[model samples]
Target: MALTIKEENQFKYIDEGAGEVLLLLHGLFGALSNWEGVVNHFKSNYRVVIPLLPIYDMPLKKAGLDGLNSFVEDFVKLKALNQMTLIGNSLGGHVGLIYTLNNPDKVKNLVLTGSSGLFENSMGGSFPKRGSYEYIKERVAYTFYDPETATKELVDEVFETTKSIPKCLRIVAIAKSAQRHNMAKEIPKIQHPTLLVWGLNDTITPPLVGHEFNKLIPNSELHFIDKCCHAPMMERPEKFNKILSEFLETRPNDS
Candidate 1:
């Protein structure tokens, strides 16, 4: 099903279903389509919201995790979201970590996959190479355990984004900021029940990153999907959704 994009004030997002809230945040290069599977599966029983992160258009100085966190906070307040499950991937997870740390009362549960608060390889080693479709294709393919997961359309989208100098600059800035801002000291204070779903073959964040997250977060558990890489939800949605479903079910009812 093609999801509708609702525009309210300065925010543009996909808000589907109604009941409990499941706010999904995508990575630096990610789009709303990244959570298509999650939305389709959960919209029947829960509200699945995916906000289009202004990664390319945000001010160059604020083109990092902190800025993204602020955007999410403002969006949440505008939508009056509360006691929600905040799910994030890659940089989005990093942003979610910061937001949850700052507003713990708003978030009841946290879910992260291939997150990059601790560390990440970033775009398969280096910044995006402009004017090189082949290089972009190769880097996008490196995101999944199966190279076939990197469809031509997906490659084209990323290639188009990299072709612009301004977007490339912002992407690089955010990537660098994520690397510099490590949350090893702060994540342990997160009291919300957290879930870490990682890819066994993830090269960007790697399996060790997942282990580190589980070790640092006091109330968190880790699960790894075999034969998957960075974007588990896009590559292994069925498995990712199953793990997430079970996790969500275990959350205690709000009093």
Candidate 2:
């Protein structure tokens, strides 16, 4: 079950189970369900919250880094979440980083996958034509090393969600802003224990970026998955979950 908290907090989210909170944030053009497999694995052990980020569905209110951060803060406060283990992918990772920096006391640990806000600004892709099946197929293919992982149902679902040109344009704008963002300097300020996961075959953010993150973020670790792409959780759920389980289960937190 879900309920709207605030005007700025337009995230479609899921909150379930008990114990410590697992706050899952999705990437651009992604919804809450993107982390379904991961959430299911951890829900029994921890309360899970996977929010459908506002980037996927354009809200009447304009969104930026500040707005996104505010939305997350409100969501957390509304739910009275504490000692959260934040796990985000792609753009969601970028947002989570910003939030943790501002509210470090609320978070116990962090995990980012195929996250944006690294060195590069431009997201390379042949968008083809908007609202077309071919465009969806190309995007799905581009995100995964093995195109076969993006099943027809998944592609079709993305297509239906992203059919509107105006919405797509908003997403493009959000992506552009994400690309322009340079969190290199701010990332080091984060003192929370962090785990960086990346796909070896990921062309979107690339595996090298994970290494860079490991260096910049003091309390951080990096894990590489072979034959995977940007969406590791979706493409290789079992392996991704195992690595995440080890990190979340055993990592010692200062708090």
Candidate 3:
């Protein structure tokens, strides 16, 4: 029970369990809860850490790739985390990719879900400018294969979170920073074993980008979840967990 509840920080993280560490980074506009279900699944076997990433609603924390990367690096050193299996979704994936590239020795395995660093994504046209139920509902619709997942409760939750101007500004900075990334050239240089899981119907990052990452990252494997959108962990947890478990449990050179 004590291990289940996360202590607060803008970079708030929930840490639990023992053995190897599985650090999870959720997609943009996501909180620790986004990966809570996944965390619970692995907590008994792995030391799971899911951080509440920079969000539009999070106060004071300025958002940028470098800033986020610095935070993660510091988090690693402060926690004395080593040989971790990094699992990230979307923007989180992009951050994890950059961190892994810079510190390959620290990462045992890398798993990215609909990652964003491989290619440029022009997905902004789907979102509205304000914090309204309908506006957030529409935005949430774009992240999942089934529109029903973005329920009114979810919309209300998202709307309440984004009701600040400063946070929205932070979001803009993060988005711009994301577009500035072109890690494709460096992807081949990453020697760590990577697993790229993508949603076949992911209009946000798209499957084409997954194909590109698969080609770029050597000693890598790609798995596509059918009928899924931006988030396979949320949309198809059973299949997602199975693939993730197999990948994480395997040794780098194991056949």
Candidate 4:
């Protein structure tokens, strides 16, 4: 389905269906399309919302996890969203961690997949290389265990984004910031029931990162999808959504 994007002031997001809210956040090189599977599957029973994080457009100075967290907070307030099932991927997960830490009351549950608050081997240990479609293609393909998941269209989109020097600069800045901002000490304080879904073959964040998250967060569970890599929702949507669905259904009731 072609999702309709709602524009309010500087924020542009997709809010669909109704009931409980599932506010999703995407990663550094991610778009609303990244959560397409999750949105489509949950929209029937839950209100699925995804805000476009200003990764490429934000001012270079504020192009980090903190900046993205602030954007999400403003968007949440603008939409009057609360008690949301906050879901994030990659850098988006990093942003969600910060947002939940500050506004624990607003979030009813947290879901992180290949999040990067602890450690990440960004872009396979290097920044994006401009003017090289092959390099871009390889990097994009590296995100999934199956290289075929990296379609030409997806590769083209990323290649186009990297062609611009300004966007690359912002990407690097945000990435570096994520690496610097570790949440080990802070994540333990998160009282919300958290779910950590990771890819067994994920080379970027790796399986260890997911285990670490489970170890740090007080109320959290970890699940790994075999033969999957960084972006599980995109690569293994069925499994990702299934795990998420079960978690939401069996979530512990509030005391």
Candidate 5:
């Protein structure tokens, strides 16, 4: 039986630590394992719950997009999470955005790193559409500043996740959702204090997107990390930790 939820798309979760609740959602091609470096930092001060997104296993027959929606619903329902802080990276960031928009009162703070919800506005060039292999190639290249930083291991990991059944379904679901899902309209309505963290050299989402988010969302703050690319948490954990800790600690009250 699944420890977290009853859905067919099972998630491996680490339900440890205590204090204020901090739910971490990973981006596309990412799992809870990716957040290992950051979880410990928050463990002592918060109840850190890292949910492994539906990437590897496929338990349901529904479209991957609906499955994701279900995943979020199940997560919120399974635990009485209130006044919690939600943090997401990459595709996970996109998910977090939607989660907050839907359940604004549930989230006290929002943190998105190198998120991927905005339209194509790259300083380098336009991104390829979602389906083609060239699109994947360009996205991979765009996510990093230094080409050499895109190690073979990273490439292989990316490919493995994309080629999987669950991920493919998820891609289709998110793409469909993105075409019509414009959080821009609801941005002004989001009352949670938000932190938008972006890599200055990020070509995928670009710093402009973060700025746009900051401008649209009422109480949002943007922090740009120079000399970094798409994955700021992974590219520079020390800085990421410092910024994150400061934000969570200074949130006035649990609200």
Candidate 6:
């Protein structure tokens, strides 16, 4: 039978590579395509699995308000997932953290990059004041260390993707829904070896949040990538891949 796991919603994904499994999850408005570079690099030596989150190519409502939790349940049904390594970005990172906390037995290592699920009010917090184009623009601008890197093409792509979502309110609604997960209390529950990656110029989640996570999550190491932004895997594939490879080298066998 083909590699497949059933959850509440039928999602698309990639299950390639061999040896210890490494599950990758992407952020909002992201799909399996987000980790194309990372998956290509590790597929030779590791079993890389990328789940196409429900919100991709669809409206936020389609992903379900509790989609994150539902996705984790789907992962549990995958018999190959026992004691595997997990790497997630943005919203995916948040879900990873939650999974690790509730089902530590399924995770050997956790890697969160420009992660979310923390900062209860980050998207709506006082910083940017939430739900405004200015907030989105400022957050996007802050994600990159070099503002010049925010090319018009990139900005337009983001806007277009958000517009495609039904009702066009999933962006804010997802952010609001994520606030229910309090990382501050959950951080202590994550005991597996963890690696936190941050983009120095990140404005959306900010580098300071990474530092905060490092301090709160015991036995976790933080790596700061200068000249990078929100999506390091896409912006600096070489460096991001190298860092991930090095981290995996030191971890105990996932088997």
lDDT of each: 0.93, 0.79, 0.80, 0.92, 0.71, 0.72
Model 1 TM-score, all chains together: 0.97
Distance from true position, residue 150, model 1, in Å? 0.8
- Tens-digit lDDT string for candidate 2 (26-67): 887676667778877887878888766666444535555666
Q: What are the models' TM-scores?
A: 0.97, 0.89, 0.90, 0.96, 0.81, 0.80
Candidate 3 Cα misplacement greater than 4 A, ranges: 1-3, 8-11, 57-62, 120-128, 252-255
Cα displacement (angstroms), candidate 6, residue 89, comes to 0.7
Clashing residue pairs, backbone N/CA/C < 3 A, model 1: none
| Deviation in Å, model 6, residue 177 alpha carbon | 1.4
lDDT (Cα, tens digit) per residue for candidate 6, span 67-159: 666666575575446778889888888888877877788789999998886662244322223335555565555556676656666566565
Model 2, residue 37: what's the lDDT?
A: 83
Given candidate 5, what's the lDDT at residue 174? Answer: 56
Q: List the residue pairs that clash in candidate 3.
A: none
Specify the poorest-scoring 10-residue window by lDDT in model 3: 120-129
Order of the predicted models by lDDT, top scorer first: 1, 4, 3, 2, 6, 5
Model 4: per-residue Cα lDDT over 131-175, one tens digit each: 899999998898889999999999999999999988888888898
Which of the two, 3 or 6, has more lDDT? Answer: 3
Weakest 10 consecutive residues, lDDT, candidate 4? 122-131
lDDT of 3 by residue, 119-171 (tens): 64544322346667666778788788999877777778767766766666777
Using TM-score as the measure, the top candidate is: 1
lDDT of 5: 0.71
Off by over 4 Å in 1: 124-128
TM-score winner between 4 and 6, please give it: 4
